[model samples]
Target: MSPIYFSLVTILLSIITITHATTITVVNNCDYTVWAAADPGGGRQLNKGNTWNLNPAPGTKMARIWGRTGCNFDGNGNGNCQTGGCGKLVCNPGNWGTIPKTLFEYTLAQPNNPTDTIDISLIEGFNIPISFSPTSNSGALGGNCRTIRCTADINGQCPQNWRVPGGCKSPCTSQGIGTCGANGDSRFYKQRCPDAYSYPNDDPTSTFSCPSGTNYRLTFCP
Candidate 1:
């Protein structure tokens, strides 16, 4: 083989090798936001199929996924999906409001500033937010989370929007304690009432801290 031909073939092989060596890892669940890894290959929209292109370059994961929940709960962005008054609560308009959908969020814990969302090729598993229904039937003003019930004891009279309407339901109840006490301790508190609103869990002296051995591992922006 001629020296020139040999050189050309070697260069082409190097390029192919480099293109096929990309790899990335994505850790996603149904909690906060929908996260997708930007594959370097730039394939077609594959998230709908749970498939990603070839791995992106190291520190090349960049992209903003829309919040999964509260997509179109309300017709318009008016938070009122109704004509008379029989409208389900729409996505709360304004800055960083609650979403009606349930999802998970994955964040990269690397100590590097990614130029874009695609610059990070890995997800921080420790950063997962298990979004819970904040004040079920009723919506709390703010600084409050949804209430989950284990039984239909209160006839769905928890709060304005907390009542489950039909019957009682239990979701993600076996997490820890319904309400954690201050000093990072645990007490025999009621788990979520069937029809209850925002119960006082953390206040001046009721900071809901994780159990003694548990850590504050949340992925969403606190």
Candidate 2:
């Protein structure tokens, strides 16, 4: 071929390679499973056979659904899940009925593998039981936390100064509040406690109760 023709061919090949490279992405399309639990001061009154919102991170692909079962929360104490066992969120056919426990599935877009993250929200239903155990402390309070009401928004639910007393954190104990281990952040721990305790126990403190017929939503970490 002529020298001029060879030069043009090489330039065209180079451009094509660059364009293809630009389109390639590092983060592969993946599927993930997100478990849902009750919100802090809420989610305790729900029946052991209630349905939870398995929220997913935005821009992410939901592949499968799996979790434990039951609700566990203390109706008394510092509003923590101290008990190790009471209720759990698991993959069970009975709770899902015929619909299959799968919350939803989606396809993800190409990612740059950057240190960025996505956020997602989900709405869950509940049967808010009646008369949640109240705290021994004296304080006039009123609110039908019982009653199976629908769900409300949970934006800003997780605050910056929220901490879960002691060194316990997620996977609360039977009492609903779990130990955050040795080196734990008491601030972020409490703010994130509501969602954490909602999984195992339906009650935390006697003062903080879930009336039957109320539903709640919460933001959880992925």
Write model 2 residue lDDT over 63-168, tens digit each, in one string.
Answer: 3222212223344411222211223333222232111111111222235432111111111111111111111211212542221111222223323232222112
- Candidate 1, residues 42-149, lDDT tens digits: the string is 211112224232333333322222122212233442332111111222222222222221122112222363211111000110111222222121233332222222
What TM-score should be assigned to candidate 2?
0.20
- Model 1, residue 83: distance off in Å is 27
lDDT of 1: 0.25
Q: Where's the lowest-lDDT run of ten residues in candidate 2?
A: 22-31
Off by over 4 Å in 2: 1-90, 93-141, 144-188, 191-207, 215-222
- TM for candidate 1 is 0.22
CA deviation > 4 Å runs, candidate 1: 1-20, 25-49, 58-68, 72-222
lDDT per model vs. reference = 0.25, 0.24
Q: Please name the candidate that would achieve the greatest lDDT relative to the true structure.
A: 1
